[model samples]
Target: MPYFSICGVPNCPNFAHAVFVANYLSEKLPNFFYKKIEKIPREWAVFLDELNRENKWYTHESPVIWKELYQWGGTKYLIGGLSEFWEHVYCYYGLESLIPKYALDELALDNLRFFADKRRSEARKVKNVAILGAGQLNSAILIQDLLEIKTLRKGGVHLVFKLYDHHQNIDRSVFQHLNDTALHFNSTSFFGDFNLVELYSSAEDAMADSDIILNLDDYNPKDADFGKHMNRCTIRMKMLADHLLVAAKRDAKIIFAGSGPLCYMATALSKACSEMFPNIVVITADKGFPFVTAASEETGIEIHRISAPVVWGSIGVNCFVDIRNAFFKADVYRPYRCSLTAPKGSTLPLGVVSSELRLMGYKIKDAGVIERKVKNNTKKMEDLIGRASLFSKLRAIGLLLKLWYADEVGDEIISLGVRSNGSFHVPKGMFFSQPVKLSESRVWVPYSNYPLKEKQTKKRIKQCILHAKDVFGNLGIMYDPDDGFDEDWDDYSKYLGEIGEGEEEEMYE
Candidate 1:
């Protein structure tokens, strides 16, 4: 981190905020991230003081330029692994205890380099972070966290936010709380000389030169008149994206956090609908777990709902007695194509219900009536372990933060079910979530589960993307990847080289 700081790269603090947003919204916002910090690491404070003495860090481009020079074979030590660089630092700077110990043996060093790969956090200088739909409380909470809390990490960063929102009457109470707390803060972790929060009325104004953009708006997609809403929102999103593409700085990471549920549903639906005629027979949901055949053309598809009492089994809990009859059934359901409603759970289970049989043995379809049994099993698991709404959404947000910050943990690894970036085996704009080993854009598709260019996977991914494109494109948005007006295609060098001085003569010859 001190090395990155000295090199002029901006670093994000891994700050955790105390949630004072009241208990009413506690159901949506979990308590895990809310806990207060007990102690600040003493070593980090000493490091900060040492960093303050360096003039190279205060100036921006020099450190970055120096780094680029090093990467381009300027420094032999740094060109190798982190340990090699640190070994020299230990001798030269005498900061032996400050840095992680390097290996003495060649084989040991090689193994350590492979195990603790430091290349994961290699992105340079992200100073500007923007949030779309900045009016929302959740958005504000994220922003407020940046302003107020500062966690000690490798490279300390100064953040500037360009917030864009339709609702201008933003509740700035969060900032007030941060400001009040900033005075009481013992550690000099929050903010640098360059910190600023700028508000923008338009996307064009907001996106320019932003290193990271967090888009949080759903355009009221969960509303009753969502079809009309989608049309309006989609147009707005397209225009917004156009502005963003043109305005956002080169190599900017745009965390497109808009409507993940749609992607999840489309993927699930595609899976259920893959390769078959509509007949009541066998189908597979999980590994060798066969089920969900529709009895008729129109089968009632509902988000799986169970009475709250059935889940809790305790009379003391008020939520168990709510008049809504049943909780939001996101986890399970009858698999089929049906009307989508807001506040309901997921469509994956319904996708399972609607699809026809796969392979059938002697009366296997009759034996495949395990929908009720599966739901019961799932419910039991949930009861034992407990379940929460918006778990996927929250997880996605956490992932975005980790990626944005380029977080480095120890040997421990975490996996997330996220939308694929059209990398490796996954097709572009895959709506369904795939299990990926979490860390800066490192997507792993198991060769055993999915063979390279597996026909079924390819077909399903294609189907999902097409449906999303149709639905989202109707509202003037390209929901899936397309080559239309690609910014990457625009090359000024082409005009210079394509029609050169001798181009006409060469053509004639």
Candidate 2:
């Protein structure tokens, strides 16, 4: 049987789509098969343990829970929540179901008729077709829809199944359930064979002599909370993307499925294939899920929603307009927040994650892990500035320290500034992380460039470094300048001095 696959991280909502389409296609068409990718769960567990320490979560049992914790804490919150993730799977499935079962059979019959006429007119070429990402449950439904499409297309397209997973352990019941269901329906129109191999590797080998690469990998967060899960998932996804890019570079037509996140990933992959492949189509069904929707905006990607049945029959129907057209017509790249509406702007979808975080006593400020590097870097700069080194080499080294501190320690500096903004504003329990530099200069700033409680920002920066040293043990910046910093911090003092001493003020809009 020819193969189609669905690839996703553990507990992926999109997995439902894979399972649905695989079984549906297999049952409706004899030559088609769907397979999924699985990974070694233990390896994931080890990785989780390592990350837990860095996060300071420190849970010894239940790697599954720990992984989920990481994801929920990381990017998942930044976007929306798990429900939004599930909506992607649901919308794709729901839309697919809208295609009447018999309607697809009729379409298949039409395709047979069309191919018959064409074959008689000119010898028909054998089309080796495959659908990727077929392991998820929804994939079974997607498969059924594709079979109806085949009948309408006249059964000319042959298929080969590619079910790829990293792990050998697929819940046997799921496979048995699908195999049994497929065997029962037993339609004889599909062409090709089925083989389940390790993902990406198998996909790469299969694409070596193939004409089309159907991609279905998206939103895979390995063992982390939803918030940080996508980070690891994207690493493996990049490999599959590279393979698709190679095929596209070789002029292969690509059809992709899934939600907004997948669409975002596709932009980079498609660009790689852009020069080689003439047409690239991404089919997504956004059910107005907040997370995927916000992610769509954040990534600067567009998803086109078409009637599911039309896609199954391979017929184009009323399709979705680009998100910008549907909402913000201009300022398309504007950041998504609570304040944005449609035609002109759309309000950000308030989701359960953020709401739940608030309910569970999680503050938005606690969303990220604070890096320790900021404190260390700040001290190196302070020491270099205080040192009156006349030696050119020592002065040169000091200059580099201040630049590094300013750039890398921006978050540390900001945290100090915000703390000075007042105990009432930022308050306790709120922490700053993920330092980013500000490029714009403001003559009339909201707050003075000083630390809270009338302290100099530089002094605060220096004090934080000293506190860290006392807590974590002496890191030896002032003790050993050469070993402490990479460069001369003395000369950098001239630049740091310009920041000046001033009273810190409130930092609110």
Q: Which candidate is the best by TM-score?
A: 1
Model 1 residue 385 CA deviation in Å: 23
User: Candidate 2, TM-score vs. the true structure?
Assistant: 0.29
| Candidate 2, 270-325: lDDT as tens digits | 33333434324343221212222332334443323211110010111111111111
User: lDDT of each prediction vs. the true structure?
Assistant: 0.36, 0.33
Tens digit per residue, CA lDDT, model 1, 1-509: 11111221122111110011111223454431111111224444444445445422332121111122223323311212233434544564454433122322333344335323543333333377777666443554465555543431336555667777655545466444434333333233345433356666676677788766666554334566656655554455446546655676645555545442333332332233323211110000021111222211112223222211111100100101111111123333354545354337754343543333111111123322443444465577568866512233434455435543554532222222234454333334343233233333433221122111222223343344445445545544334345432332234223334545333234324
Clashing pairs in 1: 1-154, 282-357, 282-358, 330-345, 335-350, 335-353, 335-354, 336-350, 336-354
The candidate that achieves the highest lDDT relative to the unseen native structure: 1
TM-score of model number 1: 0.36
**Alpha-carbon shift of residue 100 in model 1 (angstroms):** 52
Candidate 2 has an lDDT of 0.33
